[model samples]
Target: MTDSVYVHMAEYLANPGIIGLAQSPGDLVITEFMANPAAVLDSDGEYVEFYNNTGSAIDINGFTLRDDGTNSHTISN
Candidate 1:
């Protein structure tokens, strides 16, 4: 990883209504993110997909994933 990151929004937030794959630096990338509303459920499931958009492999050993902005859960690399 060159300390760069990429973030692709789900189809719901686009003009054409489709997911986009934008690549960026890993250092500036966000560890935790969300999928489009269509793919993400509302308080139904207790799990979310944390995509590694670094364009390379990433090790998320001590990372945190939160849905309600308060309670956070950790995932292994």
Candidate 2:
């Protein structure tokens, strides 16, 4: 599954000229995100994990996580 995702992203990046949309490389990615937990209730179980895929550090202070257009949460360090 990971291989397929990489393949698709590679294809998308390679054909950006045809799509007329250029995408720059990103540093952070959501390695794990769970809205519900098996061992605990939702109130205490929802969590997200991010990985810095770049060499430099990343500050995600102003980043936002949104489930929909109206509902969102800001990430702060």
Candidate 3:
């Protein structure tokens, strides 16, 4: 199994990085996500985990899981 994440930030998102949100609330939005391949029988496996890179809390159970773009799992919060 692998863990994937989706984050909701109340501001702008930038690539390569962003700056100038020191005194403003909801001025930056950043989400950290990752996914890895599933394990197979008799084979070495890799899994993915996600970390929150912002000052916020993420509700993981509210997300759904998919394999090959097909519905595989649905998390209930």
Please report the candidate that would top TM-score against the real structure.
Answer: 2
Task: Tell me the deviation in Å of residue 61 in model 2.
Answer: 0.4
Clash pairs, model 2 backbone: none
Residue by residue across 1-77, what tens digits does model 3's lDDT show? 65434332223233223232222333323333234435455324533355454465544453344555443444455
Off by over 4 Å in 3: 1-46, 69-71
**lDDT for residue 42 in candidate 3, whole number 0-100:** 32
Q: Largest lDDT belongs to which candidate? A: 2
lDDT score, candidate 3: 0.39
- Report how far off residue 12 is in candidate 1 (Å): 30
**Counting only residues 3 or more apart in sequence or on different chains, how many pairs clash (N, Cα, C under 3 Å) in candidate 2?**
0
Give the alpha-carbon lDDT of every model: 0.42, 0.53, 0.39
Candidate 1 lDDT, 1-77, residue by residue in tens: 22222333333234332223333444225544443346555744433545565455544444444443345555554
Q: Can you give the TM-score per candidate against the true fold?
A: 0.33, 0.55, 0.33
Per-residue error at 16 for model 1, in Å?
A: 37
lDDT for 74 in candidate 2 is: 69
Note the residue pairs that clash in candidate 1. Answer: 3-26, 3-27, 4-25, 4-26, 4-27, 5-24, 5-25, 5-26
